[model samples]
Target chain A: MYRYDEFDRKFLAERVAQYRDQVRRRLAGQLSEDEFRSLRLMNGLYLQLHAYMLRISIPYGTLSSAQLRGLAEVARRWDKGYGHFTTRQNIQFNWIKLEETPDILAHLAAVQLHGIQTSGNSFRNITTDPFAGVAGDEIEDPRPYCEIVRQWAALHPEFSFLPRKFKIAINAADADRAAVKIHDLGLYLRRSDRGEIGFAVTVGGGLGRTPILAQTVRDFVPRRELLAYISACLRVYNQYGRRDNLFKSRIKILVQALGIEKMRQEVEDEYAAMGDEREALALPDEAVAAMQAQFAPPAYADAAGDDAELAQAAASEPDFARWIERNTRPHKQAGHASVVISLKPVGRPTGDCSASQMRTVADLADELSFGEVRVTHDQNLVLPHVRKSALYDLWLRLGAGDLATPNIGLASDIIACPGLDYCGLATARSIPVAQALAVHLAGREAAIGPLQIKISGCINACGHHHVGHIGILGLEKNGAESYQITVGGSDGEQAALGGIIGPAVAAHEITATVDRLIDAYLRLRRDGEQFPDTYRRVGLAPFKEALYVAR
Target chain B: MDDPTFKLVTGNRLRDGAVVYFASAGIWTPRIDDARLVEEKDGAALLAEAQAGPPPHPAVGPALIDAVRDGDRVVPATLREKIRASGPTVAYRAA
Candidate 1:
């Protein structure tokens, strides 16, 4: 983890003090609600349907044990004893008092965390692969680059107020775990033919309202010119992106209006125009080296590849075996595995972690893995450096804390947004629907196998329903809650938006509709096919017929 | 057409961010039953009045909610509002 320098510490302290004064003024009636709205949003505060929501950025989804403990303390003291980790790898406290927000930010600063750039029309938290350093197939760990981007984008004066909120994601792994293709700007870290490190940059990919996968704008930019190229891309967007219409304000819309080729040309021209000044923006080799050194892989013990103790435990306990298969991923380092501590337990709202659970996971991270935790884009926690031998003991600890639910990549492991429950923009209830579906499919999850069910309350696509294998979008039709289903969506190497299967079903019929669709997939799927693969192979006709046909 | 008359003035409390309703005797209460249901024509006036006075009570973005009287209790007409009035539809906290 990157420790804060004196400059970083001072910046956070000043920001907290500034926000504290702003909150005071707003509460004292010196600042009107209209005047204070943007200021609050800039600091990651939003007044939602039922209460205020404070989104705290967990930069690149990386947290040390002490930081996780700090978040647990925040949840216990300031919130309703829990926090919701979001798809953006951020955590949101839904019930927040206006007066307590400054104090909360101060507490976060003590842990070297801040809510800055988590909201507003600014660069949001830069995301990367959760298994960045440990993944076997990775070209290089993307966290150093993510950290560099984070530092550069944090309240950049010129780009602070863009046409809309901008997001950047980087992936160095062969497998796209970070969902980089669906970001405003996506970077793939690669080595050129000459063996020099560079980036493959994609621009204008997003999911909300108009979901578009990013187009590759630059084939490769060397490590030195990385920041300059990114600056050029932002410059083009800031200059041309629509400001009048909020709906058409994102860089995606700009890319659509001006073809990707034209947009690339414009960015290239801007880069050229900067001349010698652009070189100043480019990060020097020493700076890159320093950042990379900070993110160096943890020291590993010279142990045998196969652990006899782990093998014995697995053979003896079927439950442990199931958990190991479902919750753990192969690591680059021998005898080490990345364990996913599932936040999705049956019948609970997805992505929510209680104060005690947070503390427990923090302790587990310290004990079993390195004293670091990674938050997945799917709203799960990752112990990225767990030893194979410690799997059973870690499982027992996690099970006791209600974190070891062997349902990773299963039907019950649904990703859902805080729909009508918290968001004012939501037209329907997403959490309840997700809960109902999880419970309905709890027994059949193993048989169903690796089906992603994402439910978004509205078209904002906060839950990423657009890219779910079984996407459910909640809508308001006439005066009733209706759910529109989309199938064949995926957020992977081959990313594609789901197509709607049939007419919007009523809230009560959503579960049954999903059940029918699953039954159809099971019947039509070939051997070893996932739901998405089967859906893509058979198309929507079979599933649509199954869901809509009268019983 | 959406019913405008059967409305309840709702806002979150500034001090604690609790969902609150503008009730009778010009007070803000967390209980929905204590809410004063106003006619469509009077809704705007009542909402304005509720938002006019306080820094502590009904803080920001106070608006009139389309609601109906279910026996003696005031209930939000929209599903979204219902979820807001009550807590989360699903179990929000861990067991």
Candidate 2:
């Protein structure tokens, strides 16, 4: 919904042109493969198995119907019939040709979308809550701030090449949907005691070869000094963070080496040195106003017959009611609902959307709701502002297009990376493992309850297995795909890295092993306890003991 | 531990021999494969090949390039527009 202004438009266009030239030079043998990899990663291109996978960013998971349509067109013309929406709210085309990439970028530029910072050991795509503007528990919309941060972080000279990839997530609500606590930098918009907007900044959170929760560096940073504070933090990390050892390069490693208190003190000292610089970085009211204006909520009509229709639908179609219960949520506008389209079916690849489905999603975004959709980090689509009265009609259309699925946060819904299927770094096939687990959980959807099962192809933690209530990491042992399960991982308000349950399970036994683990959980859980609550109450020992029952 | 019998593609489209990048006008011409294919130290060849595809135009958002070569497969991390401009065809055309 944030339209590209002239500055934003020109910035993106120039970047595309630069990349085009870079690409041409690389082809001409002026640049080598190793040299080109970093550049390409900065642009969100990955060479996966079978074909080249291109990841397009959906900044903070927001997209207009036009942009969505643009994505669909890209998918239809260049990739297979669909594109996979990623856990980072980005879209990936599984198949692409090397030569046609420039034209692809040119096409994206026409629609004001680029693939900058989607990858590489640099500051990556900045993510935020999908329900940024509409969520009821929000302080103020964080989208404007996210946009500001996006502009500042886009090729910032100082932090461009860091020790490792950096991720920043922002949240404006009491409920954390952006997984703020598990990022390199997490910003929470909160009103200070003086009634001024400020940010509660956290640092050192990341999941990769090593996973760590970010420590709260500053409980409250004045909103006016947001960018300056961030710059200071980055400066500290960039200076002291490891560069020699790729294994321990993340800011998280630095935070771990230095206790949270010391890290906090360091960031604070850096902030102090920044002094007047913070004031200069304060976004002018006009700029904030202009950015804020780009995200004005659409005019919403009264919820004339929303309740009645919803009630009728619930009574008439239990499945539809369950779907609404899982997928639909309150919108800022009256008589409207924010609908989430789940990419996870009973046994399809997680985050995999065919090009035709991409087009359908775009068309539906234009026709049914507003011409806008948001992708969630959990690998789902959000029609951010949709009229509640049109929920049924929208569902019908989406169902026709195969984009409508009831599961949103259910067990069947999974978050997975392109493991062995595409990623060369993958030890095991995450998508298949996810599919198998989904099959195991299929018939018992009710029993499954609300579970976040994330599968990462490897320790890079692209699938965010570290935060799943049931986290499964695929590893290679004796040249065979093996899985390591972690319990009690959470990415919500109280985020924590999951602890490994026990010995690794063979890949073929993954689904069965997970089933056993779930059964163990079901038995151990107290009345009305979620998986996270159960794991928290009893710890990993009980689960481990149950898992190795035979041994 | 690397899989043998591999060729490069621009984005995901397969290429013959070792061509790495796409030139202007959105055309991907064949280029000599980097020695890294035989020797791993020169990672630039692989990286350059992946990053060698056409860049996005200014009208598009900023272009970020990334590549993943899983054995014979070559994937460009930045490849939606190319897919959109051309119809869905997995294999590359003969140069």
Candidate 3:
């Protein structure tokens, strides 16, 4: 949606040149590993377990079909013919070569894509609801504001190096699909009594060793002052956030120690000190209108045959009916629906889209949904503006590519991190655990109803196990893989951290343990009750009690 | 607490970041099978020597990891190292 202008093109070109030189220096022995590490990290080139992993940003999880094709080209040419979509709504190429990154980045620049701020202690990719502009409940499109922040934070000298990596998510919809609460800074658009748009900003909510929900600091800040207000919040954190201990360095830890009131006061004091600079940083009305124009709502055709065609298709193929029920959502446009192409096929690694699949989705985006794609934070791709009449055709094409898995909110739609399999920091394996759970739960997932299961290889919580209704955190215990389960975690507007239930189960027992937990939920749940609702009704006691029951 | 009788020095190849094991004659090989096994006595010394080289080493982040000879093959002791020696345990990218 938001195409890069000439200025953006020039800015990206210069950055690529710098990265190319840094990579060249490293390869030629002009720079040592220690010296080159930070530079490489800044460019999102990580030296993972088996090979280098290059994380490319999809700003606010939005992409054009052409950009999707460009990513496919990078995966096919330089990587292992596939890319892993991550929890941050970005894609990571796991098999990248250290020397080939510069060439790959240059290729990405051709399609207005780059890996900047996808890693390091910098402002990471700005994420938002996959159903951003299209969601029926949205107050306004948040993508324009997300784009604004992306430009402001990219390589900002003041925030280039924070205590640790920063994450920000903005949501305009009632449904918190972006997991806005579990970020360094979270923004929700609100309207004042005068009907002017403003932000309900939250600070210091994150998940790592210490997970905390973001506390609302500024209930409302006017639209024009958005940038200056956020700049002040970051300035406070930058000035006083911890730098001594690596584990205790996230803004959440700072917020925890200082308390929310003190932290709010500090940020407010910083805002007051900013004074005239705040006026200088104000977002103008013209700028807002310009951004809105770029993300303008697509022209919807008043197709008369949509309902009849959908009914006929559903009657013809029950599988298509199941898919429509699971993978599609209501749209703001009367004749349209937002389609989620499930990346988590049963028995496959979650979020690993093949080169051909990327190419196929890119083509499908153009053919069906206005040539745009949105990646979900839960490792799925969204065709955000699909016509209701085109739904059947979209399903047929997606099915052919094996992208039509009808398990959107079901147990099999797992979210997992690249754990010991790919990450050097992981103590235990996560991908295998996710695979096993997906395979075990596939046939009966429909019966289980809407559920969220997330897995992380370690406590870094990349898989966002902290928010899963059934969260599984993998750890190494006595030289063997062990998994700890949590219950009642949610990442929606009513955000929460999960509670651990008893001892960590051995690797072999994980699937069965999860099965028992689900069975417990089924037994305890009332009609139409989801996993989190059931968990809340019947606390962790019943789940814990059921976990180690005689099998 | 981490006393394994046998060990092998491992790192990633500089150019490609491929998992490599320290072999004989100051060479690094992608295959763990070709890795030269060092006893606990010589493991620290070999690791130090490999890590102390001048600018631009053949491999980076060299460290000693426990490994034992499983019949004719030099297999890594831990699952993490085993996964590193081979590729990811899960079949990804293809599907």
Candidate 4:
């Protein structure tokens, strides 16, 4: 885990103090709503449907046991006794009081955490693969580069007020676990033919009112020039990105309007201009090395013998076996595995973890993993490293806390935003939809296999519905809540936006509609193909016919 | 066309950000039943009063919501308004 230095600590302390004064002024009625709006957003505070929401950044989805415990404390003391982990790898407290926000921020700062750059038209939280370092397929850990980007983007004067909120994602593994293609800037770390480390940069991909898959801008830029190249891209966007229209402000719109070739040329021109002073902008090898050193792999005991015991335990316990199959992934280490704690259990709102659950996970991290936890893009938690031998014990403990549902990538693992329930921008409710779908699919998840069901309250795509195998977008039609279903979207290695299947369905009928779609998939799928694969091969005709046709 | 005459004014309290409705006696209450119902002719005046509450009142986006009176209680006509008035339709633990 990366430890904050004295400089980081001091920076966060000053930021907390500044926000404290801002909150005080706002509460005293000295700052009008208009005046305090941007200021509060700068501190990652927002006035939502029912209450103030505080979005706290978990940089690159990485968290230490101490930080997790602090979050639990905040949840218990300041707001409600729970927090919602968002798709951006950040956690939001929905019931924050405006007056107590500063104190909560202070508490977070004490744990070397802050909500800086979590909102506004500034750089949002930097997200990466949850299995950053431990994944066997990873070429290099992306967290160090994520950290580098986080520091560079923090309070960047030039890019503070961009055309729209900018999001950056980095992925080092072959699988693209970070959902890179949907980010404003997607960096794929790779090794060149000559074994030099570099990045494949993609730009202009995002989901909101308009969803577009990012196009590659550069195939290879050396690691040292990563910052310069990113700065060049931002400069181009800052110069020409739309500011007149809120809906057309994202860089994806600009990229679409200007074309990728033109966009690439413009970025290349700016990059070349920066290259003239490359020594100043390019991160030095020593600096990169220093950052890399902070994310060095934790010491691992040589325990290849533990796998035999793990196998024996899995054979004896069916539930443990199922959990191992679904919730655990192969770690880079020989005797260790990365375990996913499912937050989307049936009958519960997806991504919500109570204070007690948070503390339990923290304790589990201390005892099992290396005192580290990772929040995934799918609103799940990850223990990046756990001994294969200790899987049974960990699974049992997780079960006790309602965290072990054995449905990591299954249908029950739904991604849902707090829709009309709490979000002011939502046109319809999402949590209820997700809950209903989870219950409907609970018994048939194993049969359906790995399917990503993402629900968004509005077109903002906070739940990443655009990339789901079955995307449910909630909208208001005529005075009632309705849903629009999309099919075949994915945010994996081959990212694609889902196509809307049919007209809007009533909220109450969504589960049955989804059931019809799944039944179509089941009927059409050849062999054991997943939903996305089957949908890709067969197209949406079968599902569309099944859905729209009379019973 | 939907009747826009029957309405109620609502906004979140500035101090705690709680969802509140403009009620009788110029007070904001967390209950929809406490909201003062107004006809289309009186909606503008009721909204003005709600927005012109004493200092440290609701901070953002105070507006009149189309509603209807059911027995002694006022019910929001639109789904969005209904959700705003009674919290989420689903079970949510965030008090």
Candidate 5:
């Protein structure tokens, strides 16, 4: 829960006023649509298939109870009474009116939130693991570093208008839950020989029209020099990244064309030139301490009976036990755990929350999780701190809002983009596909074990299909909905892109094809093997044969 | 090759961003049945009129989409156009 200082609050107010005037002028016929479009996008408003979609930044996915309730109010009053949490850990109101966007932004600003940098070719939300601080495996809390980056990158004049939109993700844990390998810039926190924390930086990784894994440009840069080193990387990219062609403008393409070696040399030269400026760019020790203090761990009660009470609750209710098995994660603090609220019930659109559900979650957060909520990159919500003794009560409260599905990383927990349902850029519908898959896999996911199924309607890969253990990409081929299946992709520390299996499956056979693929894995896998591990051991031949070979 | 019988001009309303169709009497309608179906020859003119509405234009991204007469009613020929004319195919939380 990082606090916003006076400067942050004042700047946000000024930005809101500026956007309000922009909307007023546009509505008054003073500015053309072409002229107003970019201005609106700068403030995170986009005209979509049905209406304007307002993307609000959640800055590393942290949300307070007040902010959540404020979002619910906006959704109820102005737009549709629902908001979609995106894969980037941001929330979007799908039915915003252009005339009412300024007021919606104003409502968000009062809660210390805004749509700034959620759109446009600027630094989008700096994301990290939802369980960053509380996870038992974490090296350190990543939120303070994310906040530091947000303060530097938001409205940065130099890198704002880049070759393409930039994304940065940091993971400081043994597990890469933040999908670091699929971002423009990925940072893995590392410890030097003397126990000082630093960053292991990777550049050029992305999942979109052209999917590429990032290459490590530098093995380590001390925490103090993060800003200077990152500045040099962006400076080199800003200098040489292609702007002539829209499709080939991402830094990944630049990294590909110039080769990582040359790009590294260029970045190093830029860094060396900074000299004393690098020292100036270094974050002061006092500043770092202050930021760290802002994210200090929440106080926990000394529990006399934590697991004893939890074991009794589990013994009394099998459903609560199942949910605890599937949804709750271990916390670093004894007697506490992180609870994941599933937004992916069968036959529902992924990541959507009704206004009432938002309010309910807000209430539950205040009651159970110290008034804090975190949105996951996989489009789920996390109550990052909860007593193990209170798991049954939390489960019961979540069920009232239909958020108690016991599927977290299961196949039914699908990640699909809004697609043609609400998105203007989609070629085919992705939401229906995901919903259908979830329905098809309803009761069998637990038996099938952990599988990641991600769907993207277009090559933009907003749903991150390239990183799913089982990826489904929907495309419109010859005016008909067609789906392409890919296997063996993952977004963990050992990340790999999925390989497309055969030609695109017809729309009618997508789930059936998934069934066959899953069956193949179940039949061939060794004991205790997940889908990706089995695929890695055996490659694509077995699955390919099951999918394409004539019976 | 058999092609669509008529062209329908459509865009989203500038104010609320609602999907709208160019209708008779120089007005926009939210329903597809009220849309004015122009012949191929008149398609360009209809699209131009829709795109170049009076100051403080009522629509954005106006375009001519192919449609065909279904008995007395008209329907968009492409799946994309039809989905746009109606809302999303699946159920959603509507306000």
Candidate 6:
């Protein structure tokens, strides 16, 4: 939770004024509609099928209770009482009037939030592992670096207009929770042999008409030179990147055309030419120091909290025990447990938050845990630094609020984008399709086991359906809502795109099809095999047969 | 689909223009009374720019200016979409 300094405050104020003028001109007919479209896009406004949709950046999905309350107020006053949290960890107000957008942005700026770079062909909101500081296996917290990248990329005049929208993700933990491989640039922060922090950089990952797992551009970029390396890479793409063909305009396409070795060499050459100018990237250590301070674990009594007593408590509350086993994880400090607030309910829209629910989370954070919340790339929230002494109490409160679900990295948890309900580009309804599938899957709750089901409205792959153990893509065929299923897709230490199961099924039949596919996996899988493992073992033939079986 | 009516709405080149169409709820409405022919300066710049790429752009939707036939008179396909997003610039209606 980095507070905006005077400089940051002034910068946002100026941006607000600029956008206000842009909106005024558009409305007054001073600027042509076509000219205003680009400007509006840069400000994160889109004229969709129904009304204008405004996307507001949540900045790596971190929010204060006050900020969350601000969002709740926005939903109640301006929007439709709920906001759709996006795959990029941003939020979208789907039904905003064209004229009221400037006021919306002004309100957001008041809370140090703006929609800049949320759209257009610019640097998108940088994402990281939701369990950054709390994860047991992480080397260091990745938020400071994420913030640094945010400031550097926010208005970088040279690289503002990229050939295509670019996404960057960083992960410091052993598990790649950020899905680093599927980004324009993915940085893995790991310690070198000498115990110095460094990044393993990869480029060209995306899931659109063209789905590509980025190629590794550098094995190691020293901690001090991370910014330089990134600037150099973007410069290389900006200079030689294709503008002639929109399809081939992405840096990934360029990287693909020029081979990894050639691309790496070109980046290195460009970086070398820039020369080490420390002044250009003068990140205030004090700013990062303050952010780290904000995220520091609260003071807890130094005691394992009577292990025998805890074991007895676990044995008593089976539900609580299950939640603790699945949802809670070890913290660096004793008597503290890192808590993950599950967004997946039995049958709710994935990554959706009602105004009340959002306020409750904010209040809970303020009272029980640290005053900080983190949004995962997977679209869940994390109270990373919580005291174990407060564990049972936190669980009780969360359970009352329906936030206490014992399914993390499990089958019931799903990632879905707002489809036909909100998104204008959508051809079919993804949320309802996901809801139906989740409802059906909930029946075989125990048998489903640990599986990842991600659904997208279309092939843009915003919901990351391509990388789900079982992927569902909602599409329209002759005005009928149809869904295409994919199996064997994964986004872990070793990532792979899923293979299509068979012909597209009607939206109504998707749930049954998915059930049959799971049944096929269950029948074919070896003992104790996870869904992904089973899919890898038997391939798609068995699942395909099961999915398309005639009633 | 019936023969699509088209018109020139805005931008010198179709590639640079943010061409929208008559979506379900009329997200794009007509901005003028009738189609306006691309002025000489704009037309030459558009042709020069169009050489960078072809017509009927991708990503957002179809290119409206692609229907231009008579150097000046906007074809039906472009006219229909222009009127839909911005409005008609001329009094003449489809015969």
Taking the tens digit of each residue's C-alpha lDDT, what string does model 6 give over A90-116? 888755766777788888888888888
lDDT of each: 0.89, 0.76, 0.90, 0.90, 0.89, 0.73
Evaluated at residue A475, the lDDT of candidate 3 is 94
Q: Give the 10-residue window scoring lowest on summed lDDT in candidate 6 chain A.
A: A276-285
Comparison by DockQ, 4 against 6, better one: 4
Q: Give one clash count per candidate, in the order shown.
A: 1, 74, 0, 0, 0, 23
Better of 3 and 6 by lDDT: 3
> For every model shown, what is its TM-score relative to the native structure?
0.97, 0.85, 0.98, 0.97, 0.98, 0.82
Better of 3 and 5 by lDDT: 3
lDDT: the better of candidates 5 and 6: 5
- Which docking category, incorrect, acceptable, medium or high, applies to candidate 3? medium
Ranking by lDDT: 3, 4, 5, 1, 2, 6
- Estimate, for each residue in B1-95, the C-alpha lDDT of model 6 and write its tens digit: 44333333332211122333322121232322233434444644543432333222211332335344444434433222333343212111110
Q: How high is each candidate's interface RMSD, in Å?
A: 2.2, 11.6, 1.3, 2.4, 1.5, 15.7
How accurate locally is residue B7 in candidate 6, as Cα lDDT from 0 to 100? 35
User: Model 3: per-residue lDDT, tens digit, A1-551?
Assistant: 68889999998999999999998888888999999998988888999999999999999999999999999999899988999999999999998898899999999999998888888888999999999999989999999999888889989999998988899999998888889999999999998899999999999999977889999999999999999999999998898888998988899988999999999999999999998999999999999999999999887778656778787888888999999999999888776889999999998999999999999999999988889899999999999888888898889899999999999989999999999999988989988898899999998999889999999999899999989999999999888998998989999988778999888989899888888888888999999888788877888898888865744
Better-scoring candidate (lDDT), 1 or 4: 4
Better of 2 and 4 by TM-score: 4
Candidate 5 per-residue C-alpha lDDT over B1-95 given as tens digits, one digit per residue, 9 for 90 to 100: 56558988888898899999988545889888889888899989888777765667788888889898877777888777878878888787643
lDDT of 3 at A447: 89
Distance from true location, Cα of A299 in model 3, Å: 2.2
Q: List, for all models, the DockQ compared with the true complex.
A: 0.58, 0.06, 0.73, 0.58, 0.68, 0.03
Off by over 4 Å in 6: A276-295, A300-303, A306-311, A548-551, B1-95
Error of 2 at A464 (Å): 0.8
In the range A107-213, model 5's lDDT, one tens digit per residue, is 89999999887887778899999998999888889888888888889889899888888999999999999999888898898888999989999999998889999
Model 2 lDDT tens row, A1-551: 57777897888788888888877876666665567777777777776645567888888888887887788788778765677778788888867766678888889988878888888777777899998898888999999999899988988888888888888999999999999988999999999878988899999888888788888888898877789989989988998999999999999999999988988888889988987888888877788888899888776667766878777877898877877888898876666778998888677787776656667777777776668888899988888777776778878888876667887888888999877666647766788788878878878867778889999988888899999999999887875778899989999998878999888988787777778878888888888898889988899898888777845
